[model samples]
Target: MKNRIWIVCLACLWLVNNGVFSQEVSPRSVFSLNEGWECRPITTVSKKALFTPVTIPHTWNTSYSEGTILYDRKMMVYQRPLEITNAMKGKRLFLYFEGVNSAAQVFLNHRTIGEHLGGYTAFCFEITDQVKEGENLLEVWASNAYRTDILPISGDFNICGGIHRPCHLIVTGQDCISPLFYASPGVFIHQENISEKEAGIRVETHLSLKNKKEGLKLKTTVTDADNKVVANSETAVTDSIVKQPMLVNRPVLWDGKKNPYLYTVTVELYDGNQLKDRMVQRTGFRYFSADHEKGFFLNGKYLNLYGFCRHEDAKGKGSALLPEDYKMDMELIKESGATAMRLAHYPHAEPMYDLSDENGIILWTEIPMCGPGGQAFTGLVDTEGFKENARLAVKELVYQKFNHPSICFWGICNEILVSDGKKFVEYDDPIPFIKELNGLYKSIDASRLTALATCVDQSYYLGSSDLIAWNKYFGWYKDAAPSASKFFDDCKNTSKGIPVGVSEYGGGASVNHHQWPLAMEDRADSHFHPEEAQTFCHEGNWESFAKRPYLWAKFIWVFADFPSYMRQEGEVDGYNDKGLVTQDRKIKKDAFYFYKANWNLEPMVYITSRRFVKRDNPLTDIKVFTNLKEATLYINDEKIGTMKPDEMKRVIWKDIKLNEGRNTIRVEGKNGRGFLSDSCEWYYIGK
Candidate 1:
């Protein structure tokens, strides 16, 4: 039975992948280079270089000592033995690295082939002339050391070292679609104009030709969700580029979370009659805009973006994760009823973007120009090298992710200011650089908008980007909870009208700690982050955010706790506990259900403060989070009063008496779809 079940699961997975953008039939042959690699860290006074067998999707930070923030920021040398066959002699061979740390240098047969500066983006190196048809040595020297030129000079998250993402060996025809253009797929599909009546499309194919020959033409085809060809065109390959335009009448739109229809794009290069190279990708036709007085609109409809900011790091894996891990995270996000996600601090793995496209979850992806938070200082510098590197990183981010329709906003930076004695200071003027990045993104793709996450109270970079969001922590940091609305109003009352948002809000949480009266004091940097405090912070924050439509989007500070080398104040050190869910992806905090009850349409009844099992006060309030209209409270299986939830989906029974010993607390509710119930036990010490 187990074997049969496994086979069924495999079959289902194959069906799903085939239904999506996986290539049906392709001429290119791609191989995984993820296994059997010997790694060693370079040292100053080395006695012996003992290499350890490691995998491609591996990181050295996983072995860091627990409760310590220090990671081994050394240059790691990974070597692998490759045997080239005679059949692959005539084909163009390339090595593609999805991500390597801060820098990487590739060597073939002890000779340097290529080097890349940025870490979070993808890059490829051609190895056609460097290899023979026998055993060859491939070496990659990866380093994560702090560099002044890198955009993220300082961030709250750790810069994990090693080859943290996948690497592939691609072999294709000599005259085929080039994959060397910043490691992109060499094919870009543009939704020139989209509407319910007609859709305009332009397909650009980048080619690598050996000779200028006649009868070489490119064919582009678009297929709808039902595998029906919607539009098709052909154009001659001229000067290593082919552009074809087509139109579809009465097109099906890719709406957000409503329909999310998609169209498959296939580009084939043919020399007269024979096919040479083929590429397959997915794209959707949609239009959106952000109005200052109004809110975000998608496909001529308003969409209030309420989601979470996510970091790619996990508990044991650090930033190195497999495709399955990303898929799991996507499932969790969908389950929580989120319509959008903010890929914060850095560009995540490619699978994350693909999942967003497939699941129709809007994304706000960004580059790694993260700013300093606490003791860390330097964010932006006025050096030529730093400016040049930042320029390249922004361009690469825009070009590589040009075709993903799910990405609607390009975030330039996050919290780009340093604290200076109760005031924040920007030592170097960041407006010029911000304008440069904003212009670069618009030059590449003008369909989407650009955003910046600032921590300063006012609209400092107001005209720098298309939108501006303040990362304010009112109740958790210093001011009272109700002050958030006043702050938003203050920003709106200013002269310039710019689309505003709440980029980061909420407080830290630890499941172990519990307080009855809910400590209203500020403990932003302390280790006593009770679970109730996080719940209270969200309850207040959402109350203000829900009533204001001018606030375009509100992204919770984080979706899951992540590793931060500078943080040492939580249930465990070296982690930021501001996430709605734990780092291991195991437990969802009480605050997680609070948002689920309000945002998700699925019927659910969750008893908050269940982790606070031991209670000293016999008379306490019973709070239940349920999307249902009304829920009934039962104490020790006895009948209690049924109450309706408020506008925030919160139902509370005030001052309920409990048994002296263990008391059974349960809440049952139902919606039009189905019924749900949740139960927990609380042991009363004193009665």
Candidate 2:
């Protein structure tokens, strides 16, 4: 039976009806309070105890767990007590948390102010009322254990707990910009014809007002990077919602591959004479569409989307990543020769959106609900709690990161309801829960495409998404490496009607430093070693196992190997060595070079793997994939030959010349796609 219930009042309605005076505040922080938060474990006797000491940018699991901790272990809570200082006395004070895994409840001097359910989205609370004169006690209770109410009760990877992100107290003016506001630089700019010299530029801006009585006036300006204003407009506040329009005589349209020129739109909010807030958003003046028949098109040009799925996990820091970390990741991604990224599983941290915005990397961001489990569908969807949580997640994500130009698609769920156990097949009936979720996303943000990652089941569930994405691990998990071509053929043949995208594919490899020929055996025994002889011990080669899966575009299970305690064995400890980079971020496995050969566009040098090498095998068959106009391959310092990159054919370079000792092979390519080069060395010995 279908059960229906309204969980919580709409947050906007709640804000208006509460009788409390609303204020507009800037989302940007003036001070860095994230560094000084004092944290501790929440105990049973005191649901809001303040005993443990920790720092900001800290994860509860990394410090608490000595080794790989099982998911079924005891429930843990993280609490942080903050003291309000004189510098933050009069201004409107709010507590902002980038993220909290699973469930979090906030308290000011022991009084419950607000609580949040989802772990991937940002949430804030106005704590001006809870503060004392001199100092204020702020406490946050975060939990990551299994709960029927939580959406992700079961899945791969450890649910590293705590305030797995930075927490801060934002102080702003009485009429400051609200932290939650959607900046839709809407499809104001439209182009009629492409080859023509002049293009039409239409601008549309939406400004949200928190304090209705304050009444806002908006001033918009379009400009080039040189700071010269191209067009400008001014409008007075008539209603809480405002829309303004303007025209540019000749606009430079933004296109994906053919011509990728973007423009900047700046909107400023003013109260009488004082400037209240300002937002600068970058948007392209072009229209595009995606379908199975034509693939991806920008301004009437067909562009095949190629990229890898990125998880928001950083080395050493768990999920609590800083802005610099996001920048580094984006750099690596751009270096990989892919133009886009599928932020796998959930919407990433806000900084990632910022990085993507600046770097021109297209994004496919999804909600946190992932995987296939009975509790995910039966327990989560049927209950009122789960629905409310989902609603909040959508609202927060859409409102916070909507302005980003890089985010092209909003994915609903990961590979959830489409799995058929053996091979991929469709669900018997439409998962009403998913339908409701998709409806909510469409209602909130219809500007972008709606996508979902399913297993191999494209025929039955293609109707559920605007774009059907498949997560196939044929070469690694199911089939052999040599069968990759067959898998691709199966994918193409089966996904005839749907606009298909390979969402995930890749294998694991341990680091050279951590690599011992006997390490895999040690790891198997340590993790899977049971108390009784009935326990079965399985042994296998880890490196050769990973080499077989590096064959496709949506490849690479992970960019780096991370810590995992579940199902571990032997000397493996807590590490899952499936990444191109190692856990400590020091070494690159051979697979990294294989991908570099396939992705890197510049003429550069890179060492693939330092581990096992075949004796006297100086000439390694290096695979170089490029979108450049042409590419040149060289062995040692000598030039070899040129080649072209074709979407239909995988580029493979065979029998490159190598020296007897340590020979380096390099390839350089250039075009509008930019320059790329890569090199690797091998030792040779002869009788």
Among these predictions, the greatest lDDT belongs to: 1
lDDT, candidates in the order shown: 0.86, 0.58
TM-score for each model: 0.94, 0.74
> In model 1, which range of ten residues has the least summed lDDT?
17-26
Instruction: Residues 397-484, candidate 1: write the lDDT tens digits.
Output: 8768878889899988887763343565536767788889899888888889999898875456878899989888878997877789
For model 2 the TM-score comes to: 0.74
Off by more than 4 A, model 2: 1-29, 44-52, 63-91, 180-216, 253-264, 282-286, 372-381, 418-430, 481-496, 511-555, 565-575, 605-610, 613-687
Write model 2 residue lDDT over 51-99, tens digit each, in one string: 5566666665543254435432233444444667776666677778777
Worst 10 residues of 2 by lDDT: 531-540
Clashes of each: 0, 26
RMSD of each: 7.1, 12.3
